[model samples]
Each structure stands twice: as structure tokens, then as C-alpha cells.
Target: MAPHTHIKSVHTLSPIDPWWKRNLVTYHPTPKKSRHIKVPWWSRKCAAALQAKRHAFAAWRKNPTPPLRQRFHYLEAQCKRVILDEKRLAWASFCASLSFSISVSQAWSFFRKMVHPQPPLTFQ
Candidate 1:
């Protein structure tokens, strides 16, 4: 038979929170998103080819091989072509959107902006 000892219980009084404070809206700040515009990948095939070229590059970096270099070069050319096509398409779309009804001043301004896009000024 084991001897049992009586345990003493202590009471704790924590400050009661007000009902209003309990329901108060708390703002949780999240990471700010980048303001830069995200352009779409040239094309699905182009994107895939680019990824493959990257893999080949990593392999070449690890061990310099003539075959890997050749493949990477070929894929690089394909990627460049795709990128050029995408750019042309986007420009075409933008130009098409400015219907005939657009004012001459507005069209001129749009054309000017397209020709020389003022880079966003950044203060370091």
C-alpha cells in the first residue's frame, strides 16, 4: 500500500479583457508585392525549351562538355526567336486597341511612349 499526500490547489486571477477589445479588428501586415509588371512567357514550347537549356547549362557548368554547349547554344537561339515574336505580338495588340476613333494627340502620345518608354525613376 502507498501513502497518499493531499495536494494544495492555488487560484490565479488574470486581468479580464474587455468584450470590445476581444472583438476589435487587428491588422496583420503582409509582405508588400512588387510593383513591376510581369510579362507572360513567350510561349509554352518556348518556356519548356528555355528550362531544358537551363538544365543543359547547369550540366555544362558542372562538367565542361562540347555536346552540352552545342545544345545550349541551339536552345538559346530558339528562346531569343520566341521572345522577339512575343514582343511583336504584344505591340501589335496595343496598336490594334487604339481604334480609328482615337484623337490624333492621344495616338501621337501613345506612339511616343511606345518609342521611348520613360524608365521609372528610382531614388536610392
Candidate 2:
């Protein structure tokens, strides 16, 4: 056989390439229902403590030093304590408000909300 004179082109595009380039992918937004349920025990103080604990954790993670780790632990304990205290107080107040006059449906509604709160959906 004679010497082959074959050549290959690297920059060749297929016929369907133009169709893919011309049509853009689009996404439609999904509608969601908003839930405005309120927690009886959550407060601004708890939020602040939790934020501080998160910051301390970030600092500890960045440096991994003993001091920072200790600080993070302390903040974590403090945050837990504050949350527990707030919950206890809320529970106490709720117990104090209990009476024979309260309707069964209203009490059950409160219990339902407290026991199984529906979290908002995130578009992750």
C-alpha cells in the first residue's frame, strides 16, 4: 500500500452544536407558601447569644488554638443555658395561664404548633 495521507481536524463542530449554542437553558421560579408561625420561647437575647457562639466557633476553627477553643466552648454552654432559661420561663408562663375557661381546640392548637413546627423551604 502507498503511504497514507490522512489528516484530522480538531476544530470541527457537529451539526447539533449550533442548536445547543442558540437555545439557552431557562428555569422557572416555583411558588411557595409563607408560614408566619411564631415561637413562644425564642427571643432576641437567645439570638444574640447564638450569634456570639457561632462567631466564637468560626474563630476557633480558623486558628485551632487552645484559647479560642475554650472560648468557643464557653460561648456554646452560655448559649445553651440562655435558651433553656427562656424556654423554662415560657413554659412556666404558659402553665400559669392554664385554666378551665381555655377551650380544648385552642390548647390543642398551641400544642400542635409547639410540637411540630413547619420550617420554611429553602431553594438549595
Q: Evaluated with TM-score, which candidate comes out highest? A: 2
Supply candidate 1's per-residue lDDT for 73: 85
Q: What is the lDDT of candidate 1?
A: 0.57
TM-score of 1: 0.51
Pairs that collide in candidate 2 are: none
**Shift of residue 67 alpha carbon in model 1, Å:** 0.4
Q: Give per-residue CA lDDT, model 2, range 5-85, as digits (tens).
A: 441321243454554323322232335656656667777887788888989999999899999999999999998898778
lDDT of 1 by residue, 1-124 (tens): 2322341211221235333233332432345876633343235655666677678789888888899888778877886676567657757876778788889997766555444422212211
Task: Please state the error at residue 78 of candidate 1 in Å.
Answer: 0.8
Residue pairs clashing in model 1 are none
Give candidates' CA RMSD values in order: 13.7, 14.5
Candidate 2 has an lDDT of 0.69
